[model samples]
Target: MGVLGIFKKGLTKTRNFFSESFTKIAAGTGHFDDDMLDEFEETLVRADCGLPASSDIIDTVKASIRKTGNDSREAVMDVVRKRMLEILGDKTSFELEEGKLNILLMVGVNGTGKTTTAGKLAARYKKAGKKVIMAAADTFRAAAVEQLKSWGERTSTAVIAHPEGADPAAVVYDAVQAAKARKADLLIVDTAGRLHNKKNLMDELAKINRVINREAPDANIHSLLIIDATTGQNAVLQAQSFAEVAELDYIGITKLDGSAKGGVAIAVAYNSKLPIILAGLGESVEDLVDFDPIDFVNSLIE
Candidate 1:
């Protein structure tokens, strides 16, 4: 399936949100009155679009409606789409670059689907004819190694792991060495998800970075923080904590399919200024997809 097909699981909630909002506004009978505006603001907030974003959207639509003397709900919806596009900007995704070993350091809080995402990403690269290997460096998590190994079996990619409670940095060091020996094109390093302690997170991530630089100086490691879309504004806090410690290049919002707060994608993009490279729509291997901003926002409206 294509990107949208993979993401369609999340589109239902988005559809219900906008559809309900559109109905409420239409019930106002072409009036840009206070009640309508309040409902609109509430809808945005409930959808996980943050306060500043929702207010800005409301004000812009109201201005356009006033200027044009068109108080139709359809006009407001059009303005909402335009505002979403503006927030999305012109960011094309950063796909796996060829010819060099692409390292994706997956980071996220517990249960945000980081491990599964790594496995899916490995499968994606393998399907694209690249040699892909995964480092199960999340040594602190009890089942992390076993989980990644299972995924490796499912995807038919090689997995590297050390014993439990071993230094994750050491696992990554070994994985990098293996990747070089095997001439692998992609090496995905998985890390443990501890509480958002700046010193601890930074120190651990620094160790991994140091190891990668020492072992494979030419490898480009992209720090991608995975945020759970269901958390809504809380995701902004998580993203901030992760970015403060590491030079996060991109974000992967997972479990969009199960979240009414799918609008967290917009809130996160607006707040973090980090491109959302991918979203997880299902548990299947093909469910992970590149985040298409236009298609995503349009799906919410449609």
Candidate 2:
């Protein structure tokens, strides 16, 4: 399916929720009065768009209604859609450097689909005919390492991993060397998904980063935070915590198929100012697709 088709299918629940609520508002008193605006803002917040983003969108809608003197539902919703697009900004594509090794560090809290995203990414790059290597650096969880190994097998990509409880930095160091020796184009590292507030875990992530920087100084590095869209506002909180310790270049939102709170994507983008590079629409490796902001907003609001 195309990007819009994929998003429409993946965001079915969110679209239904938004469309139903909006239909009610349009059927209401049919005026963009203060009470109506308050209701609209509440709907946005209930959709997990975050208070700040919902308020900004409502304010923009109010201004547009007053300026244009068109309080029609279509006009107000057009303003709403425009404001949402503004919050999402532009679509940024993820690319690997041709000559140098590109390393993607995947980080998030446990059960946020971090390992799964790494596996899917490895599969994607492998399909693109790039020599890809995966580093099972999440030594804190034996299951995570095993999962990544399974993905490597499925994707026909080599994985560099160590025994459980090994230093993650050591795993990354060895993976860097292996990528160099094999002349791999991309090396995707899977890090432990620890609570963002854990000081030791954050420090360990910093150490792994140092290892990558020192071992492969010429490699292009991208830190991506995996977020579960089902978690709603809590996903935004996770982004905030990870942004404190790591230089997060992009976000990868997962589990959109299971949640009606896809608006959290806008919340995270508006609050963190980080582009969402990828989204996991379903469980299959092929379900992981590039994030197109216009496609996303259209799917959510249409």
Candidate 3:
């Protein structure tokens, strides 16, 4: 399916919630009064849009209503849609450069689908005819290396790994050398999720980055911070902590299908000012898609 179709289908839960709540709020008059607007702002917060974003959007809606002298639901919703789009920033897609070793360093807290996302990306790049390799750099976590190796098996991609408790930077150094020797186009490194100790995690990432720089200085790299939409505002806070240390280039939002908290995307964007490069709309490998700002906002708030 096309990107628009994918977004529409994946955003079913959020769209349904939006429809139901707005229908209830606009029941008789089909227009918003002060009381209706107050309740609607609460609804946005409930949808996990975050306080700052919801407040900003509602302020925009109120100003538009005052300027147009139209309190109709159509007018209000249009204002909301446009404001949301603005909050998401410009539209962009994820793409690899030709004849370069592109590295996607997946980082996030535990249970945010970090390794699964790395596997899906390997599958996707391999299907696109790119030479892809997976690096199981999450050596500290139990079973993390095995899980990434399994993904490598499923995708027919080779995985470079070390024994658990091995230095993660050593894994990165070997992965970089292997990619160069094999002339691979992409290398996906799945790192451990240990946010409970931010300083240690940051130090580990720094060491791995040093290895990559020393080993493959010419490679194109993107540090992708994964966020679970199901976690709502908590995900936003976690992302902020990562932003302070990870030098993140993009965010990959996962688990959007499991809840109506899809507005977490908006919250993340507002807080981080970073582009969301990927969306995990479902459990299937094929369900992962590039985050299209226009399509996402249309499917969500309409």
Q: Compute the lDDT of residue 21 as modeled in candidate 2.
A: 88
Q: For each candidate, give its TM-score against the true structure.
A: 0.95, 0.97, 0.97
Q: State the TM-score for model 1.
A: 0.95
Score each candidate by Cα lDDT. 0.85, 0.90, 0.90
lDDT by residue for model 1 (1-302), tens: 56676666566887687777767675747656767877888888889888878888888888897799787767778888999878766556656667788888999887889999999998988898999999998898769999999999999999999989999999999899999999899999988878556688789889999999888898877888999887889888899888778889989999888877888888888888888888888788987888888888878887
Residues 156-215, model 2: lDDT tens digits: 989999999999999999999999999999999998877844787789899998999999
In model 1, state the lDDT of residue 78. Answer: 86
How accurate locally is residue 277 in candidate 2, as Cα lDDT from 0 to 100? 88
Output the lDDT of residue 279, model 2: 88
Q: Can you give the lDDT of residue 229 in candidate 3?
A: 95
Question: Which ranges of candidate 2 are over 4 A from the true structure?
Answer: 28-30
TM-score, ranked from best to worst: 2, 3, 1
Q: Which residue segments of model 1 deviate by more than 4 Å?
A: none
- Evaluated at residue 76, the lDDT of candidate 2 is 88
